[model samples]
Each structure stands twice: as C-alpha cells, then as structure tokens.
Target: MGHQTETHVWDEELAPEPRGRTWRPEAGCPVEVALAAVSGRWTTLLLRELMGGPRGFTELRTLFPDLSAKVLSERLRTLRERGLVAVERRRGFPVRTRYELTRAGEALRVLLVELYATGEELLRLTTASETRDERSPGRLEA
Candidate 1:
C-alpha cells in the first residue's frame, strides 16, 4: 500500500481578510521607515557612492572590492524596490547599465554626512580614551 499525503486548500470564506501593507511604518514613525529602507550591511556605503552620480556595476564593485557581487546585486535590488535607486541600461556593442539615486536617495546624503561626522567624533573619543588608559599608572600596555 502507498502512503497518501493530503493537500490543504485555502478557502476565501475561512481565510482572514488581507491586512494590506503592514510592513510600512506608521505615519508618526518616519525614522523607522528610513531605517528600514537602509538597514543592511554596505547599504549606507552604496548610497554614499551613488550620491556622486550614476555608476556602472563594475565601478561600484571596484569601489568595494571585498563585497561579493551577489551581495551588491541584492543591495541594489533592495534599494530599487524601496524607490531609492533607478537603473538605466544603454544598449550598444557592449551592453552597459548604470544606477543613479532618485531624489529620495539624494535626500539621504545629508543624513549620511551627519552620520560620518558622528562616527569621526566617536573615533576621536575612543582614541583619546585609549591613550589616557595607556598613560595611567595602573594600566599595562597590551
């Protein structure tokens, strides 16, 4: 005797009403939405690079040599899905594609600049603290 598996069918009458677009952050939480859009490794760096203007895939890959092509492609797709980046393809002897930041993406430039500034400040503070610790009488340099 052969074992039989049962398949379940979804019935509209039994199904719950679709909750439309629940992933969107509530209107009051703009920061949440912004963070959600850029929440991934190298996402900010990709945005920062795009701020300079449109760049080919090869150009972007060269900028971050350590990043694998797969991750970069994924990041670009995510940015596109979020409406932050637009891709343009030029047909020629050698097909060329370039990505440019949309207005929304350009708007993130200021935020990125502020973040860089904050990072610099944090680095300064950390280095100063390390120097102080090294000079303190009770501490031994590692």
Candidate 2:
C-alpha cells in the first residue's frame, strides 16, 4: 500500500468541523500552502525541465549535471507522490520506466514562464541601478 500524507479527520476533542469532513483552509496562510506544494530546492528547476517533454533518467541527469542521482531520485519520488508526474512502464526486452508530467503539471507551465520573465526584468533593473550607482558615487541615496 502507498503511504498517505493527509489526515482524514481532526481530533474531535480539540476542534471539530460541523460537516465532520472538509477540504477548505482554516485561516491558514496562502503562501504557506503554495510553498508546501513546491518546497524543495530542486523542485522548481525540475518542473522547468519537465515542461519541455517526457525525459528519461539519463536525459535528466545530463540536463542537470550537478545534481546527484540520489537527489534526483528523491525529487522524482516527491513529484510522483504529489501527483504532478506519472510513471509508465515500458514493455520490451528490457523493462524500463518513463516519467511524464500530469495534467496538473502542464497547468504550471504558463505561470512558470511568466515568473521567469518577471525575474529577468527584475535582474535587468537591479543591474542598471547598480551600474548607475557605481558610475555616480553621490547620485544614489542609501
């Protein structure tokens, strides 16, 4: 059996939902929720790599040469557990598995593109400001 990450019900003694079961947030921070979905250091980059297409382990390893096999495996497992990726068993002389993005993962592509663009613009602005400050010593106010 697969491990279940969520609790079905809360302890009634402490706090109870009128419906007995609920999926809505209870005054929790939104950023906390978002971060929970994409918390690992390599998760964002992994997602970006997957956005291109389904890739084999070797392909991913080549794409991110700095990541160790152990770290890559863990990240892949995490993504699979979160339902962002699906693994298919290949049928042939040598059985193997392939990973592909789920529909949920595909949905993140546009948002990721926008985020990348925004980061580029911010970098450009910051670099320009730093250059100007260096060029004119007293022009920038700290």
Model 2 CA deviation exceeding 4 Å by range: 1-32, 91-95, 139-142
RMSD in Å for all candidates: 12.9, 11.4
Per-residue lDDT of model 1, residues 1-142, tens digit only: 9998755554555333333223455544555566776789999999989999999999999999999999999999999998999999899958888999999899888878888899999999999998888788977656
Q: Which ten residues in a row have the lowest lDDT in candidate 2?
A: 26-35
The models' CA-based lDDT, in order, is 0.85, 0.78
Q: Judged by TM-score, which candidate is best?
A: 1
Q: How many residue pairs clash in each candidate?
A: 0, 0
Give all TM-scores, in the order shown: 0.70, 0.68
Of candidate 1, the 10-residue stretch with the lowest lDDT total is 14-23
Off by over 4 Å in 1: 1-28, 138-142
